[model samples]
Target: MRKIDLLFAEYGESHQNPTNKFIHWICVPLIFWFILGFISLIPSAHVAVLYYGLISVVSIAAIAVVSLYYLKLS
Candidate 1:
C-alpha cells in the first residue's frame, strides 16, 4: 500500500544516517544472539549446541561487517 511504502521510506531515511544505522546494525545481531541463545535453552530442542554455535558465529560476523560499514560510512 502507498501508506506502508511511505512509512517505510521515512524509516529508511532515518536508518540511512550513519550513526543510527550503525547502532541498529550492532543491536540487531545482539538481539538475534539473545533470541538464539534463549531458544537453545529449551529442553526439547534437538541440535541445540549446533544451532547456538552457528548463530554465535553469524552474529560475530554480522557485527564485524557492520563495524566495517560504519567505519566506511563515517
Candidate 2:
C-alpha cells in the first residue's frame, strides 16, 4: 500500500476507542485555544513590511499550514 494509505489505516486504529475519540473532541480544541491564548500574551512586535504584529503573523501562518495539510489529505 502507499504511504498515505498506511497512515490513514494507522490513524483509524488509533482513534477506534470511543472514549479516546470523545477526549480528542474536547481536549484538542481546549489545547488549541490555550496555545493561542499563550501566544497572545507574548509581547507584540512590529514587522517592517507586513505591518501585522508577531502574534497575528504566527496565527495566520499556522492556519494556512493546517488548511493546506487537510486539503492535501482530502
| Every candidate's CA RMSD | 9.5, 4.9
What's the residue-level lDDT of 12 in candidate 1?
91
Clashing pairs in 2: none
Clashing pairs in 1: none
| Per-residue lDDT of candidate 1, residues 1-74 (tens digit) | 67666887898987877998899989998986776666545545232355354234444455577679778654
What are the lDDT scores of the predictions, listed in order?
A: 0.66, 0.75
Weakest lDDT window of 10 consecutive positions for candidate 1: 45-54
Q: What is the number of backbone collisions in each predicted candidate, taken in the order shown?
A: 0, 0
lDDT of candidate 1 vs native? 0.66
